[model samples]
Target: MIRLDVSRIKNVPGETLRLDLNFPMDPVQSQHGQVSFNSPLRLTGFLTNEGGKLKLTGCLEGEARIACGRCLDLFDLPLKAEMDEVYCSECREGQGPGGEWVLFRGDVLDVTAEVAKAVLSALPMKLLCREDCRGLCQRCGTNLNREACRCSTDDVDPRMEVLRKLLKDGN
Candidate 1:
């Protein structure tokens, strides 16, 4: 619902503006998570007008719900993101370790896009429930933390069985 309006700076060369944004997380629109509100996404930065281009340099910070890697329990993930980008009428394509980054489109800069990019890039690949969670059992599919399983523990070593038998016969 927060739409950043930069129409005033359009086509103004060397114009600069500093802004702060606090966006509340709406779980209903979140990629994944229940309807729980999260900490506001704080964006503090400046945009520079460069005639036919715009440059944005800023840091974005916020908190969102994330599942624990081991336990699957939902928790809060702190996000701190820093971005430096240049927007132009002509798209600039560049590559990095992961892949290429596409610069934002022309004259009017969309602040919402800048914030979303920062947040998404900073998110973790995997979410864990807890650090010390006992995962589900492989044989019975029972959650090890909640219940115990009747799995076999009589593991035998094939190479040492002959020696074990010889020792029993005093050979």
Candidate 2:
């Protein structure tokens, strides 16, 4: 959990603060699979007191380990998420435009959720170990990247039998 002390600038409007924060990030479960962070997440930018709200704008950077979508191999992935989240002192916890506000009470702002959301959204939908990664064979389950598969490659779909028959008849 990462918390920021905003008491100094809470009541002072138009006050700006430069922030450089680094903290470890937990493993995130994504649609593709589990993504575990190998390095600490770094948020570097400024926080300005905007009258009644605290606006935080920063760039997040980290390294993570995830599986290759095509070959199912584990590899290191670099992460960089741009964030501009608002911390509202007057609004309720769950009220915002598409979860835009990070509700805070007293003089502290908990930015863990917003950071996690930014990292999650920054992850690519398709992860690949290499550009030309040949996926595993369906029948024999062979890693084509390492070695050649002995599975038969001439098996045609039954639905395409009519096209083959028509070509053969024409010949």
**Candidate with the greatest TM-score versus the true structure:** 2
- What would the per-residue lDDT of candidate 1 be over residues 25-85, giving only the tens digit for each residue? 4443234444233677787888777764667788888776765545455677788889876
Q: After superposition, how far is residue 77 of candidate 2 from its true place, in Å?
A: 1.5
Question: CA RMSD for every model?
Answer: 9.3, 6.1
User: What TM-score should be assigned to candidate 1?
Assistant: 0.60
CA lDDT of 97 in candidate 1?
29
After best superposition, candidate 2 residue 113: deviation in angstroms?
0.9
Residue-level lDDT tens digits of model 2 in 1-171 = 877888888888999878899998888878878988877889999889998789999998988789988779888888998999888888886788886677789988888888888888888877888777776765588887897777634676766666755653443
- Candidate 2 lDDT score relative to the true structure: 0.82
Cα displacement (angstroms), candidate 2, residue 36, comes to 1.1
Give the C-alpha miss distance for residue 66 in model 1, angstroms: 2.0
* Top lDDT prediction, candidate number: 2
After superposition, which runs of candidate 2 have C-alpha atoms over 4 Å from their true positions? 93-99, 152-171
- Give model 2 RMSD, 1 decimal: 6.1
